[model samples]
Target: MNGERTIYSILHILNGKKSSQTIQDIHIFQLTSLYQSFPMLSREQLEEVIQTLYKEKWLVQSLDNHYFINDTRKGELENLLKDNPLPNYLNGWKFHAITEPFWQRLSLFIQVASHLSGNSIRYIPVQRNPVTQLWLKETLHSIAIDRSNINKYLYKDLVKCLEEIEINPAILINRLTGLKKIGLTSDQAALEMKMDPSLYQLSFLAILHFMIERILSNKEDYSLLCYMIEDNKKNYTLTASTAKTYDLIQKGHNIEEIVHLRNLKQSTIEDHIIEVLLNVPAFPVHSLVSEEKMTRIKDSIEQSSSKSLKVIKQQLPDVSYFEIRVVMARYGDS
Candidate 1:
């Protein structure tokens, strides 16, 4: 809460809202790494947390009614963060879509393999997704493993990856179900590791995100691990609606034409354009915005500290909000 955005905007960003404003906020605030990191964070949960902060005197309201970190408590919070910082691998904007599927697939596969190796077929599945189960069935046939060697192959690949990545494997290993063991739930694992429950869950996700990026990068080194996540391809950053808009845009349809053809509003199509530009950097910004307009917006951004659209708009009254958004989406990071 830097007073640039309301609490609702922060909530939306954590919830991974697909709104144009939220998407732009991720770039403008340099919070793309935290984008969609907490899909389970409900509005009520955020409000409760805010209330607790207020009660603890860690957050305070200004005369303008804007919420901000209390100057007196900020140092303590910063010190705590410095002592036990957030995990390294948390590119939620990029990996949020795939992390769950990757975890489900790996968890289910491990559970099934553990049962098979133990000569016991009575245990319940760790992952109950039908799609994940179907994928497991298909993958079992496709991979180079059978009942006799399931544990050996799984162990070798698992150890190889953990050793190479050099993360504390307990966060990952504790969540995995195996032959004589039922996997620990996130909270249970957290307690076992003497960590805060929230941190444990985030660490679990960070490891999964980290593993996904690593496996995809060096498929030759982690053949078995790579096979498990073959479905997690690179093209997953855009929303479904945005993907449709992206396809049509690539086909060379103008905004108005796309609006008429897709029956979407003009604003919605423009939002999709911003999303496209942010994710696909090679798309030409000049096609949608003039060089002069882009220059003005960049200048306004240089003077804008809060990254508030209203503040930026007030300074450049003639520029349409959409035009300013176009430049911010294109070169805000640059």
Candidate 2:
């Protein structure tokens, strides 16, 4: 279904909840958080849809800044959702966008955080949202409130995170940590839980969402959780190709040498470099493109109406595509 209809369906679901049924107004932050899991809509696109709904009088904003479906239109929206339910699974890329790397990292981090007091496993840094460090520290402090009973607190938090899911929390914890006593892959866990792997993954994401919601609900301590989660998008890790390129670069290979070594075209290598630069903060862009060239490319890009590399290339023919991409990687958003 299209974004507008999907959003309407979500509003219907939320409003129909027994707890929220008595209070029709939904908090904007809560709505946005739930909506983020859906595919085919960026934050900007979602906001636009919301604005359109408000303009059409299908939804109204309260004095307290929460939103409510107009009583007159609520029946129509409910009927629409009844007629057409949102698809259970999004398209592959869209689904990956919503979950994947972030959820994967979070699953691993939770395993580490839960076992912190035991000191059975060492904490290894992984590419994660910067705010995760803050959350980790705060969570550790919460769990340490009573030092003698750290394991109790950890188990309590884990149970809370998995409360909504049907699987035994102990089994899920063992699977997550690959504990020697109950080592199991996700597929194995899914089988043991009598669920499909896809459904298991969704349940995992739901658990994460529950944890994040709990964190966000503690308003005074986690007031910035919303912004932190949004900004965490920037920390997406390197793709396979970019990671290979990064490895070669670390081994002191230049772009041309990398292309030769990896048997890839020069353009491909350049694309990999750009991807690495955009996603990997530690990537050394200065070594590949000089300050003087980056400035010229940035200027040309700003003056040009089109962001297409071909159009920008026409203006700066002397600059290679690699150089143009480097500059774009640095200043594209500007």
Candidate 3:
């Protein structure tokens, strides 16, 4: 849909409002300002465009003298006006338009597939729009049927990110889904689930429980991260100022005591310290602490009290909680 002549003027007015408007209550103020800006427009021409937009359902005026940009038309206008070398201006409508049959076909395919997961409707109020809900549901169901396609679409950087993180994809996949019961070793299952034989390099990221693992794995794969670690370590080694800062922090220095530490601001120092803690691999997921049965995992690891893998494994054998200490050890934290 083409933007009405007053589009820029209305956008400027809306931008001035600190808060967004309720759709029904925005018309006269915006329109009046737009008219004032374009004094050359005859009253008839001004009225004609507004009335025409309203008639076309692109501009909706409610019972309360309020106006709203129609959802579909607004999306079309935004796409057309988007900042790009090839803005969706010429024959873009043909490329951009969506239809029921297209979505239906995709949905049918997703449903018949077994390996795919994580398919669902996002951002739309499916409950209120029955027709749209059915269309979306069917599309998602079809996408799920073709597991590889769904995984590819959903996880665009899956393989590359996984390898970058230094995680054996086979191990991670096996961990995600317990395959031992199905007579499949985690290693075997992970290998089977590996995405795209061609582009197999996974980012250190994109793993479920290994946000920190990604950082550590990347440090090993790329030397830049190693340099960062070494540089930070050198500061601790050579700089008396750095040593004093650590001492102060260890001695419980408050913000006021730590503000004068060189060019680094107090906030920056605090952030650096927190970043260190953020990547601790003590447990792959932090939520383990809140689970009633799992609080002991931390206490057990911290004290270095000897506990067999068999004993600890019994508490939460299949869950990642049991593997937290292992992850921590891998990162040299243990």
Per-candidate Cα lDDT values, in order, are 0.82, 0.54, 0.36
Instruction: Return the TM-score for each candidate structure.
Output: 0.91, 0.38, 0.17
Name the better of 2 and 3 by lDDT. 2
Off by over 4 Å in 2: 1-234
**Model 1, clash count?**
0
Residue 50 in model 3: shift from native, Å? 36
Q: lDDT tens string, model 2, 195-280?
A: 65645654554555544545445534432222223333342445667688889998999988998999999877876776665456
Among all windows of 10 consecutive residues in model 2, the one with the lowest summed lDDT is: 20-29
lDDT per residue for candidate 3 within 57-153, as digits (tens), equals 8887653334667877977768754732221111111111221222222223223221335443232231234554565455455432354455444
lDDT of 1 by residue, 177-225 (tens): 8878888988899999999887777788788888888888878887567
lDDT of 1 at 111: 84
Task: Give per-model CA RMSD.
Answer: 2.3, 16.3, 26.6
Each model's total of backbone clashes: 0, 0, 26
Location of the lowest summed lDDT over 10 successive residues in candidate 3: 87-96
Global CA lDDT computed for model 3: 0.36
